[model samples]
Target: MKSPLLAIMLALSAAFPAVADVLKIKKDAPKQYVVKKGDTLWDISGIYLDEPWLWPELWQMNPQIDNPHLIYPGDALALIYDADGNPRLVINKAYRKLSPQGRITPKGTNAITTLPLEMIKPYISYEQAIDSDDIKDMPYVLGANENTKTQTLGHILYVKGDLKVHKAYAIYHEGEPYTDLETGEVLATRASYVGMARAFRTGDEQNGVPSSLRVESVKREIQQGDFLMPAMQGQLLPAYFNIHRPDNAVSGHVIASPRQVREFSTMDVVVLNLGRDQLIEPGHVLDLERQSPTVIDGPRGPRYPEDSSKFEKLLSDASQLFGDESDEENTTWTMPKEKVGELIVFKVYDKVSYALITKNQHPIRIGDIAVIH
Candidate 1:
């Protein structure tokens, strides 16, 4: 028989392998990313994943990201693997400097930042008419006088109605000067949509006079209660617009503006109402409301196109004659899947801002919901 002590030592050696081979962390463990000025999470994720819209997946693994509000320059992102061999994200805490000696401004009152993919959420513009049945619905005219231009573009049908508000409406011809990202310079000229305005009068003297409007360039009068708001034209810069209001329920205090619903072009561009003032710092993460695609059955008649008809006949023959061998699984094919677009808050203004669609796997329409992650 073998010696008792030797047998015990041999058994222990088989059980523990680390002692035989040293365990050490790799010199190049996970990659570290440094945040640069003007960099958003949308752009950051583009560097890592093939699809940037999958930024949310990072949070599912790492909990360091608390909010997606503001990601400033100098912040570091460390990615490593855990014991289970899964990718993990960790934030290296660094002391912020008050007066760094570069063009980048030192951290300010609004310099609060979050982890890799934390608190970022998207809010979509949802609509509900004040006294109407459906949205994008033209309200009927009770009466009319004349002080506004009537031009119907697509869904908006303008007619002269009673101007309900008596307060003098300030005609905002154009917005203030803003910095242009492309030129890296301040642009003095305003965008064309910001048109000029003038005030008029309407309504009775008993309850107070109602105000009306007239367009100078277009040359038309706007009667009482005419809707005045922006409509969808083409591709908007940001992916979507978010409405923020305190009193509403569908969208409570978290919305970017107080509007009921948002409009957008076929592309996933949008305009968020919340800007620099509404705590909407740059680099925020906003969640998108994913929507599934609708399916419709095709007509079951003879095909008009020769190619399609031949193909259909072939399929019919295969289904009836071959019975089981003609790839039966694909007999019913699904239409393309649609998911809402995921947007990343990139630009910020005083009362408005812009977001970019990080991922457009799904077709994001005009009125999807956006919320903070």
Candidate 2:
């Protein structure tokens, strides 16, 4: 007889026929595998299914698992079949033990993530998109110790603005402005990260005094007139999240990249025009496509005056075969857009969001179109 948990999984599998049909297993998938350090959920899922983004469906079928999103290192995953022969991936169960509270807990180290955190942690912790109005009021570096123009780690600086005593802050230099390709409207400006500092003394506006601060670290040289904002603390991001297509139809373009490169590929962080206003959020996956250039189908070579009449006669004959002479002269052909890559949105602002490229067939450009998969 099947166990109660297995029976429940089999029943759930029967209920969702469409999901079972779509969740296809790879022919060469292993019967069992162990989670290891540095292994991501996407990498693990790709080993079992063709569409790795459908990983959540596997856990949905087996509701007995505890915290399906928190799979940790050393845990064992087994590929099992239900009564109807539909494959399901489940924790070995033997690797988990009941605690004093009677809760199943996997014996392992830190939980695995959906993507490599190191690649995106800097962008999350240090950088941000801000409105143009906000930049006007932010505190800026008034002067540095020793009367220098630039300051580095361990240098003292004076800031002219509102600041609290012993508060941590991140230094930033205003970068390029993101704009809408269609309307030419400015969306948001990027606050490029410079370094970090801690306020030692608060400034008094009545006395015309500037706050005293000491630089703690530097990624770039902190110069006079650079701005400061509260430093982000702790790992506020989720350890694991599922990838899925957006529910509503959405389309946008890659407007910018933090690295400021012309072409992007897998693992590169990119900025997209779609954001909270468009209902775009973290874990939403979008497909990339490159539009083809239009080409003229008319004459390829120059015509001499001697052959002008002959060429005109030939053009007239061709126009008669195709359409009007004016129409033929203006006709241009464009090829279908080519599918390039995929990206997953991880950070969102008001009118823009940041996405990490997850896959690519060709190099993705700045103006490439992103649409719902």
Candidate 3:
């Protein structure tokens, strides 16, 4: 019979694997390192770990320090092992010395972000996905005060809808609709942000009076019939969060590319078919795979032969090879999908979510598959 302490240890080992497989520290990882300006958590983790997304597991939080997760510039990190020989990273508080005034100050005021803010700042602040049913009820531009076809910054525009006084709104234009390829369902429509506007006077719907709004900024010329949505206020971006694989087996396809490019690479924002309904949340890392095309094995004729008769004969032979299954089971076979890259989910909607490509070994296409890493 096993003792109670031994049974508990067995249970823990079965539940949570060792740091060697989960954390997997790199062979060339430094014993001690200093934090620097413009350094992100992902980049720092890559310096010490083979899988940077597993940084949260390798970090050992010190309860004595305030906000231990917030690592600032000049702070030193030391890689140490516990009694069980499990690797962990901890902050070296003794790295800095007291100043002449007997006070210790950090080199930088701001804490390092989880990912580069410059890459996803615009998408988080300006870009939005709206449902198709809600678009018709949204406030739209009626006209401009200057009687021009298009409006710019400092131009007053008239909007017809329920508007609150002293409220800021983002001007947007309708873009392409995102659809689920498997389910044949329209998830959401992409909103093209054009400018920012502030409402000074409220509109009276009973009197048919339009509200007055002043355009404060413009990325593009604000045209008539542009939609209006509430501007994000005091929205905090994700700075420090636990990175982990999806709890369940979640898989989806890349539905839309915001950059309007055929192929996308690292740092490019792409929309996935999975969302909150599918239990997808921010900070979840996913692996990307590109499906291989099916190849047909048949008798080869000529390379780009101009003779029409030769081409016909080749086509007939290919069809006969495909139809005849007496000797072989099938003439065509699909190759295995190749793993291309990885992406991290940052923003999620109801049926669709926005993810930034973090690692790209190959150019990701529109229909690439994203599965839990």
Report, for all candidates in order, the number of backbone clashes.
45, 0, 0
Candidate achieving higher lDDT, 2 or 3? 2
User: Candidate 3 regions off by >4 Å?
Assistant: 1-22, 60-67, 82-84, 98-109, 182-184, 233-236, 298-330
User: Please, what's the RMSD in Å of model 3?
Assistant: 7.1
Error of 3 at 99 (Å): 11
lDDT of all predictions: 0.38, 0.75, 0.74
- lDDT: worst 10-residue window of model 3: 1-10
Off by over 4 Å in 1: 1-30, 49-69, 80-103, 108-159, 162-200, 204-210, 214-226, 229-357, 360-373
User: Distance (Å) between predicted and true CA of 48, model 2?
Assistant: 2.4
Model 2 lDDT tens row, 17-92: 3553746889999998877777776678779876667655676557556433366666677888877777778877
RMSD per candidate (Å) reads 17.8, 6.9, 7.1
**In model 2, where is the ten-residue run with the lowest total lDDT?**
1-10
TM-score result, candidate 1: 0.36
- lDDT tens digits, residue span 270-356, model 3: 999989999998877899998876454434422222333554445545655666543232244447888899988988889999998
Off by over 4 Å in 2: 1-22, 63-69, 93-109, 233-235, 298-325, 328-331
